[model samples]
Target: MKPSGGSAPGGLFSRLTGFPAGTGGDGVAALSKRQWTRLTAAHQVRAVVAHRWAVVVLALLGAAGAGAVTLAQTPVYSSTVQLVLTANYPAKDIDQVSRGSNYVLQRINTYATIANNSGVAKAVIDKLGLPYSGEQLMANVTVTTHAGSTAMEISVRDTSAQRASDIANAYGAEFPAFVGKLETPDYVDTAPIRVSVTTPATVPAAPVSPDPVANVALGLLAGLGCGLVLAAVRYARVRTVRDERHATEITGLSLLGAPAVDRAAPLLGADRAATPAAEAFRQIRTNARLRAAGQRLTSIAVVGSVPGDDAAAVAANLALTWARAGDTVVLIDGDFRDPSLPGLFGVPNGTGLADMLSAGTPANHALQQVQPELQLFLLAPGTPMPGSAERLLRTNELTKLMESFRRDGAFVVLLAPPLLANADTLVLLSATDAVAATTRVGFTHSDRLAAALQVLQAIRANVLGIVATRP
Candidate 1:
């Protein structure tokens, strides 16, 4: 039968065929920039969510560090004194009052500068008998003015609340006298402008610096940002397949199914009929059947994209799934390098595929019946033929054996080694009617999977789809 396209099934097999007919380039390269960005951002968010505990831990560390620094800092108390500049000449009319207000507003900035001057700081330091120098006292002084008003504010910070209040009040008292001396000009008795105290400085009840709450909050924000950046970098640097979508994108094949990892029961045994792993294998069987609707798919080569993908278990379960449905299934351990089906099924490793290809052993004599109730048979990798396994598989005996199984209406499931691990896998795949590629989530590197798919495509092998096993 010839390979033909059909309507895709719903759910796991809904994704379109990724690779084009001739080109082996990126399957998602056709997407627009905006769509690609959204897709990448979605993956990044998922990665961050997967490592949320790390982010939380980093944020807490940052907050604790900020809180510690805040505690170690010296406490500083702040005090402010308010002053107003007014016209010394009595205003006779509304226009005169408006002119006086404008003049004060124009000079308010100058007065604010004078309030923060080193001379004023020196005078305040001398009057209060403080130990600080003029430059040191001026560093802690701040002056501000109100726009369109005749108000100026003088603030001072110090380790002692009383000293801060004294410094601010001293500026309020001495600034007017200093202005008077400068403005009187030795011609008039009083200065043209008068500076009067509007609000006297008060001792602060609490220190303004070393705010623990604000510091911790800022630190938490900064830490959270840093955590997100690190998470994104880690996600970008990761080379393994993240999920089923990632597997599909890499292999450019429809996702057959993902079997949940069950450490307690790795194989789908007869006692574990109702388990999710069994159901997943059954789903994979169904999808494989649907994918090969028009073609003859009696023999399937289960090949892993990379090492440790557990392709042997996938092949065993898949064969068991088909046999449980009343179909005669022959499970062959095609991987002579590392034969696992004998240990998996508790069958003795005797004369099997190796003997059949080299010594021309009868297929029926080499086949072992694993399940008595079900029509399931196992062909163990008989004898350790290390160097000649590839040469044996290249012979036509393998093809004839598969044909004999197909002729008997039995489904042959061959457990082949990883594509990148052994060269015999290509020979096994060529003998089989179809191939079922397996990948382990978070274990199979995407680039390795792509390379395997390219090799399969180069040989024009019939790949059914991908089966992702999640741990």
Candidate 2:
């Protein structure tokens, strides 16, 4: 029996989600709260980074949209004029001149605010005969005083560059007169303080708003941020079985090995030349031997979820590899629905597995040699028994066949039907000693693989590992 919960490798997510251990009832692993949280974050981030094309496309579209919006906005121009404040009081000494300069500097800040006031706005607007009122003109006007100096600046912004310059110069010309009248006494003809324009406003050749390069850059940044968020969301929702890592993580199965797709690789190991698929099969055979050393695993079932998962290829190559290593191996085509062993090895499927099981045919007469010199044997599906295939597998005939193969000192490798395709292979699970699942890279879905694992767990089958077919 599986334990309730601990630090066991298999039940990591199921514990947190209240699902049974080693089952995909809730589509979650049997993990503790902390472990589940950590795995979720890491897995989601990995998925997002794995599919970066979606993120790039979204980012590009976001940047293009922002650039289009920036181009649609109206451009604005700003013009500025500078003024200097000076005290007219006659100074007799150097100390008096210093004191007068300090007074002028202190009054500059006050003059800056007064320059943008409604009174100055009305005066400037009336002199220029502008269409706007005092309040409206004041809305576009701004005044700033330089630090530790008697200099003040008046700025105006408008859609037209000439209008912006006219408004700025008008404020500069009117503020000095407005200050002079306000500061002068009732009987005095002259004022103690005066303001003079240092730099006149000029019409700007370029607009300040709607900078194309800056806007496009900002849009790119925003778009990239949005794309990463979208990628993370997509990764969290969709679960696709892409490689061995995902297969092992979701199914709690060991990673046997990944075999490369090489059409030049033959079914039997008669060709001594080393190929990627051959080397991979040799390694998988070693792993299976190590796994079975502790248990009595004589009958091995190689199953897949889909038709193109290469389960038959894995079983045939693995049997040949073991036979080449001086072990007597028998490869059985257990999938009567879609028998592939005869076609794969170019053998006649006249007198094989179905005949041996149904007619009490002797194994010596039914088994076909993969090659005359090799100890590898083939038990291909003899004939199509579509209606009674599941019943034949469910009976004691399969168990007796395995017993007979075990007595002959032959390791049996069965290529069963796909788990999702039909339930014919599910009937043979009772007699199978160990199981290995095969999945095609970038083709199988995680949900179907999880369901297959759940069925294996339900039947209490010994899970050897998983074989990933690299495209």
Candidate 3:
């Protein structure tokens, strides 16, 4: 439906200010925080999808680095020797045996600490005849004890599996003697505590470190997380319109059409009438008509958000689409600095809009009929007058000419200059009944689109919608 005046209902400003849709009032309303969050999240997802290749490459690189490090490291083997500590005092009754078991459990932690001490490491090194010093041997030894039990485990690691096992076994065999000497008193003949080996250390069949599969998997996961963060940052910083949805969100305008990128030809021919590009133009024409259904949509200014947006081609195709539907369409090259409609229509640009406005030339004399069968006419920019183009467009003659076309029941489509590039576009926009903005996918910046819309809204110009075109 056609929006009241020019402001779109539920537009970007309306949504931000929490005002009632289409009111364009100063009153405040409830904010749509949830809707804004959903839009931001959608944009982030699209950004990540657009940079999927970069994410994949990073993950692969991380995995390769992890695999390289894993393969280059030296493999180490581990062996564990289990020991049980017990009370050596004789127990004749069940109560005394229970008391002896309690004593062993209480002293288990102390024995575990001694197992990992430098003194025990030195004894084990001497017994095994190993080259390592007490400090070096203790570095690789680990002692652990179970809760409510006298069982203890002494584990050792080395480059060689056989050496690891020998070191562990030596620690187990020498620990008992060391503990017995420490527990013995000067007045007693025997010690009150005893240490015994319950399980002998064995050579491990596999290394304990540098697992290739696990390292690569972890690296890949870490890299993927980093890539996602980078993608989100890029999305937030670049601020370019990602797609049709992004363009709509930035401009707060309805989507008229999304024509695919076609570089071979700027104008749609009869042979391509059944193609997607032709259908897209037809859709845009239909949507524009629908938006201005109840209003007098006599003149439509086709403006580009920025240069290189191909607004001229869009305007040309839209005129053709209307002309094909049996409407008298007047296509005008309103861009004075760089007139492209003349070249696109294969016509000479001897005299047109500029002469009619500045030199008092008759509008009928400057108009050229390009396609007589389709009832399509063209008006070139005539002479280059970049300096005074804005002044010429501001004259009353342009408004009168548009009214004259409207009286003749002819639809006028003017290819105005890029909004950001020249000020003449604003003049044309003010003179026209409605505007249809053009944006090139992956080329138009979100800030530029928003700025152009702000300019149109300042003048209260009726905006039909936006047409998205690919490069």
Better of 1 and 2 by lDDT: 1
Ranking by lDDT: 1, 3, 2
Query: Model 2 over residues 1-471: C-alpha lDDT tens digits?
Result: 122211332342233334554454545333211122333555766766866887788778878987898889898999999988888788899998898898888878777777788888888878889999888888888888878989888889989999999999988888889999988999987877888999999999999998888888888888888877777666554545656776777678888899875445536455643877788888998788787787988878999866778888888888878887888999998877678889888888888878877888998899999767778899988874656664566567878899989998999888887765555666565667888888876666676577667667765778789998776
Candidate 1 lDDT over residue span 296-412, tens digit each: 888999998666887878998898999999999999998776788899888889989889889889878999999999999999988846567656766788788888888888989
Candidate 2: stretches off by over 4 Å: 1-72, 94-106, 187-192, 220-239, 262-273, 384-387
Output candidate 2 Cα RMSD: 6.5
| Per-model root-mean-square deviation over C-alphas | 7.5, 6.5, 7.3
> Per-candidate TM vs. native?
0.84, 0.80, 0.82
In model 2, the Cα lDDT at residue 146 comes to 75
C-alpha lDDT values of all predictions: 0.80, 0.77, 0.80
lDDT tens readout by residue for model 3, 1-471: 111222231343343334443433333111112122334677777868978887888888888888898999999999999998888989999999999898888888888877787777878887888989989999999999988888889999999999999999998898898888888999998888888899999999999987888999988988887888777766656645567776776677999999875655888878778988899999998899899999988789999867778798899999999999899999999877778899888899988988988987886789999876788999888884646665676568888888888999999999988765665665677778899998887777665566567657766789999998986
TM-score of 2: 0.80
Clashes of each: 0, 9, 0
Off by over 4 Å in 3: 1-56, 89-93, 222-239, 358-364, 384-391
